[model samples]
Target chain A: MSAVEEMIKERLKNDIDPREFDKPEFQRDPFPLYKRLRDHHPVYHDRFHNRWVITRYWDVDAVFQNSEAYTRGIYEEEGPYKFGSRHVFGPNILEYGRGDRHRWLRNVIAGQFVGQKLNDFLPVIDMIARELIDKFRKDGEVELVTQFSHQFPIRVISNMLGLPREDENMFVGWYQALIAGLGFGGVHLARGIAARNEMWEYLEPLINQRSKNPGEDLLSRIIAAELDGVKMDMDEIKGFVALLLAAGGDTTDKAIANMMYHMMYTRPDQFDRVKATPDLWENVFTEMMRYDPVVHTQGRRTVNEMALYDEVIPKGALVLIYLGAGNRDERVFKDPDTFDAFRDDLHMGRENRSGRYKDGKPGHLGFGMGQHFCMGYAMARQEAVLACAYFANSLKNIRPKFKEHAGIFSPNIDSGGFRSPAELWLEFDPE
Target chain B: MKLRVDYKKCEKAGECYYNHTVLFERTDNGFPKILVEDLTTDALRHEAREAIEVCPTGAISIEE
Candidate 1:
């Protein structure tokens, strides 16, 4: 056997604990551990963390599909706000709500993101991408993540929500603090709470103004949106806006960074193909998401005792559907480890939302499925595709900037749960 | 076989088009359009059933 194949076999044979994911080495490269988990324990429980880590495609997809059996309300019980405050995410946040309330909130916001509404935002997204790229075009080398990827989505989201463009930095800081606070034992919980308060304080007067004098923006639309004559209150609107900032900003930023990382470092050939054919950006983004998604896992609580993969999970148990692992499942994708943009076996468009794989091909679970599928998916896609197309068209001789001696893809760290390089430094010739 | 879609209930999640493209196509605005309103083949029936089951909004149904 080849050296790489032998190394993989040896690593899979090692008895690695699921909790090893907390360790830096495993965090940097978890696919070896994921292989072991998928091969040995598809539904392994991490006793230390007190949660079930599901690794296989079918099991993860099943959890996403059966929302009734496994609800996102788990976030309420074990989330960072469990002990601190009830209003952290607000009562009407789409992620926590279930049944009719969830549907109403999703549909209301969904209208703002679909059809011509989304088309209108494409120019805004393209402009944001060009402006962000312009800032670093002169510099021979740039830290793409912090300088470009991180700021682009937040800017677009700020425009979409009718927020001031100058305050993008503050919003980015708030999102970072809030996401960090969501970590174990509320590491930065106080910071998160303070940020939320600050955001609400800033938004209250603006919301009131919009209510009195509505405009052609998302905030105004929310102020006007009603389901069966039930309008969202200030707190509900605040909650929804907070969720939008956190979800829309963090997820899309990481997605763009992850896609770029994969393109330049992991699969340069695919990157070249995309640069050659601009239309392939959609396929490249879809395949990149399947290969290395930004959001690695989502936590759900079991509503009742359930049996999966010959393992019985008790009621009220915390189950994490590992999207990264499912995306690379051997049973689902041929040579799952390799990143191939033209792979015919995987469903490309809105896979996670539908979970309806064409010809039984099985789609990636980057976005969750069923009732709680990501409401901002279309918006996210538009931003990523536009940004990617811009980069592919504008940059020449794009390549990763390796460290002086380490000879690696420039050392970078992963955030909690989400898998993305903290900083992706790349050298490119401005076209 | 008749394929029915509840337009009011349809969120345009796009399951039908992605799963069974031949049977359903999306409009310019992204809503699903049933191409073969009357699916007569057994193969089409199986595909339609899968689409119905996968629809997050439960907007699609098959009737004999």
Candidate 2:
């Protein structure tokens, strides 16, 4: 074996079970394994999947922040969701590009999801949140994930994209199928493909309509958006719209659900604290993200052979940066495991000291760093903050009936993805 | 430690002041007009950074 591969094998022996890749249980509780990997092989390799796993806070953060060493193309591979010729756009348009192209593409979409744009949509999102709560208020129990969590983001995104409510059900199915690929393999893979096709079928006509007669929706805006006087064509527009629905819906849905789960699970006292200080919704959301980042690991392929973690990583090697593990690194966080909702620390950005610090490094790896950091991060944070704040202000007797363990269906650290209590089981007193 | 915002870059998303009213405040113009600054306090710095992340234009930053 090559020297690098040999070192990887040795590291794998110390951490990670061989069955973790395919085992449902491992997917559910991969954190223990992730913790071990961080402890043993901070820069370990997995021969089984041929991926290098970076687990230390500094190492993972470096991978996330360094666009040169760790690139985003490796992570945006065409998965089972790739539809045949039925799709108008090629695979992985926005999520897989490099440098300037990526930045430009991000800007076009960011125009809709970030900054004041989010504020513009707050009223709509609030309406959706209230409508969902109203439906479940009288019921002593509500399955949060299926009934509310899943429903809210779908409607909000669909409306944002100007997709009619008639298409909302189909859109939800597509999102669920695409997101399922992160967890279940076979059937879900097929479902994701079918959903992709269905999405193209649904979006093609919509794209054509927007092309002929544009409106105020995000779809119309992107259709009219320009880059250096070069307008995005129908195929490019479809690709972005599809991507928005998939990436935006899944991440935000899971994040909002995860925030609620963490609030009720780890810090019940904090839940009460939220009620006392509804104004702290923003802080609560930040703490929730810091405590349990939904997108656990982001992958990057090495652009060239380079020295990493006191070892050499060959070019084209897929690198897995363990984001969740980084958030809990004792070297950065004071008490990495404890969830302090009111942690008076700023947990975002490079120079900030919000993470759990052991030695000195910052502990937050919630959003990947650098250029490829989550483009929709601002919007996602807004949705979570508003949603959580609304819940605190309006709902009553909100608590989990049965304990929820880490969900194995979605990717690492997305515990609420699989089946977030079908209902939040709140008696929504609407105070 | 006081939080400083680059009003030029701030789109006034209100994420900073919404979450950290203790250390930061937003002006009517939607920019995070930092209420206070403490360069040494890690707590204040952390909250300031969170505000910075919420800024869509990427305008907010903490200065020691």
Candidate 3:
């Protein structure tokens, strides 16, 4: 057997059960199973997780759009409603809140991220990407994920929140711990609780200082922001900051790495095309997101018993909206498996077509749709596109180093929900 | 083609203004402002259509 095949087989040995979606093998390549679910059981009830997994594009989009029928249920006392540890208090984080509260928080937060505010962050993103690339430009070979991709977003977010640059390593550690806590089982959950407490302790004082001596950063802006003349309290401010750090840092980090991985390994021809046509970087990033989004699934709850795809999902049942599956659904995408940057059938960015037509294509549900659509969609896009453009413009002969060692394109693992290369080693000539 | 924005439905995603900067500009409050109410040139109309297609909330519309 080939060395890479043997390694993969050894990894898959522990994940023998095909139905276990959380298994490492399933996480590595869930598309085959996703195709099965979509074809045979569109509304399959996962008995293990006790949730209905929606795989079809239309059904997933419907669930996202119909917020009233399927609420986030973020405030519910028990189950998966509580996003973070119970220790954190004040108003629920924007994602967890429902109804008017969600709208109010969303508006307040969304206001800080549009147009000029976003444009202002472009230079900051560009500078960071350049600096990170410069650090390893002469190294000849670099682990892109750990050394660059994972750290860039955290630094940018830290700067935005007015956090000290020297303390970025601390924030990264806290983020890792907190995420570990959010993962499956008790040990990770305990770690998550500890991380939350540590984060709260660290942030409370900073939030207090911002409340009194507010600066020109996002933390200060959020502190001073008001919805209908009611300002957010200290705890709410902390919540927002935590959410920003977590979402902005982790997701953007993974996204940039994923895009690069796709370019270097999965779609080198497209990468060459992008290099030939520099302007296509934007389209490349858009298509990269549509083809293989970082966020694989989002959790929601049915507000009431609703009939969908011939299955009557019960009230208060947890629903896993399989965005990765939806992105590749054949009914929605032509040649869904193929990665096409110039696919005319797909809307590029934060777009949502009213209806699907032969000439008209709806945006992928990567950042989601409707009221709960990702507030950071534009910011993420800008960061990714800029970082990618810089790499494409600056780096020469960039290619995956794993191919020589193991005949594998990428060493990255999907890990079920989020898709990022665990460690992306690439060799590039300095420009 | 006449362009209009449904301000109430607009979440200020900013796709329209960025995609068609010549035809739309952002107000002080960050919402979109139609730079030219009636776009006569085909290029302007094309840009406007692209902007409309990318609006997440479907806030922008072109009237023919």
Candidate 4:
């Protein structure tokens, strides 16, 4: 009924599918679109997008926490797009049912993420980060995302899962295809189908092998753990494994890329601080997760008709949680846009504030929250700290020399997340 | 009462249905479904609670 809603409807009608707009080109800079939706078409339904996108943070968070009212059905189920088939990822949304079954899966994964499982991965993360930094120190110029950001997390996750080194590249390739498909357009539908098939096929043998001889990987451990003497089947195991890959790989990879881009562009001084104190490297990691989260948006569906900020979201209508906007909300944070590394107030306690929250207040939606917080979050934080420490300790003299590129989205504005830097060039005194 | 489930919250680990096939089973889409038409008995209630606790999405609640 509103002009903006009418306009968005018209655009959706013309666009064929809202997801097609999520191409690498558009994803490179989605803020303009977000702004438009936020200002004018805030609650407009994109039937083509197959969901209503709520850009404001409060609305998103409300839907996030109110799981009972907003069913998480769409994301968990395999509709037109799923990462793998029954043959591969097993049952599509096994961990996503209603009733007691749903809680069981959450508890298992949550147990892995909540406390000690995270601490166990710390040393492994440190080793991997050092190895990467040790390798790249000689090369002054590096694409942070591809060279470092992307590589670190996957390796750590793969190692944690006890996946064969040989299969790492294969899984990474599938993950890219799968994430790229989230935009839900013509390009992605085809890519999604193909990637899904490939992933299932690839997992067939792996799943079979793991079933016969369970290994030391998290996947194997999960399979080995039985509920009252009943073991998880082959299909369920494959799905959980693939889901783990998705959770562990893409978001953290992008987070690293975003963090580096911000340091290079907005606050070279922060990099300088980390370079100077070394310990400050942890603050930079915390700030990065708080600053420009890679997982920019999340979605949920209202199960009961609800009024959000007075706007009625009908039961079953999709709602989005905008982490990107929330982190920068002027209302919640002081100088929301400014990147301050040495702010003691934000980093209240703990030994230098590396991973987990310094204040313990949900430090932005970097890893999300509530019933479905990221399971591999601790590993993600460890990888970030490891990468930063490696860069600071090893590439001591190196400084950023990123190209000047127009921002695709908001303040962060880069490919990895915010400052969509075409390339990051670093210069260091030759060793 | 056939075993009722909320698909959004179910992670499809199938632990509930594993113990009682008469009530719970895996669906075609890879999640689990409750087939029996009754929610009676302390055992059923206990298993249901376990399922709720394990659900990743918090998408389930027992309806007695």
For lDDT, the strongest prediction is: 1
Model 2 residue A179 CA deviation (Å) reads 2.1
True contacts kept of each: 0.14, 0.07, 0.00, 0.00
Indicate which candidate wins on DockQ. Answer: 1
Deviating ranges (above 4 Å) for candidate 4 = A1-56, A75-98, A182-202, A343-362, A406-422, B1-64
**Which window of ten consecutive residues has the lowest lDDT sum in model 4 chain A?**
A349-358
Tell me the tens digit of each residue's lDDT in model 4 across A1-431. 99999999886653334664456655555555555555555565666766777765455555554557866565444446442342223353433634445554545555565346667878887887777766766766565666676677778777877777877777767766655554444666567557767876777786677768987667667667675677667666666766676656766666666566666777876676667676665677667655656667666778788775546778777777666666565445577557776654353222111122324343555555444555555556666666766765676476666457343242232121333344456666555
lDDT for each residue of candidate 2 in B1-64, tens digit (9 for 90 to 100): 4556776565444445544566665453334555676656776676566556555457777655
How is the predicted docking of candidate 3 categorized under the CAPRI scheme? incorrect
Off by over 4 Å in 1: A1-18, A75-89, A92-97, A184-187, A357-360, A403-416, B1-3, B6-64
Question: How do the residues B10-33 of candidate 3 rate in per-residue lDDT, one tens digit apiece?
Answer: 866555654455887755444778
How does model 4 score by TM-score? 0.70
In terms of lDDT, model 3 sits at 0.72
Model 3 CA lDDT for position B47: 70
Q: Which lDDT tens digits does candidate 1 get at residues A370-402?
A: 666777777888788888888867877878887
**Counting only residues 3 or more apart in sequence or on different chains, how many pairs clash (N, Cα, C under 3 Å) in candidate 2?**
29
- Each candidate's number of clashing pairs is 0, 29, 1, 42
Give the per-residue lDDT digits (tens) of candidate 3, residues A1-431.
99999999986553324355866557677788788788877888777778888988988888876667888755654455444445322234544636555655665556455557778888888888888889888887888778887788888888888898888889887766555544344666566567767887888888888889999988888888876678986667767777777777778888888787777777787888888776677777777777778777888888889887678999989999988898899998899988888888887644421222223456777888655777787778777778878876787788887774221111132222367767778888864
Put the candidates in TM-score order, highest first: 1, 3, 2, 4
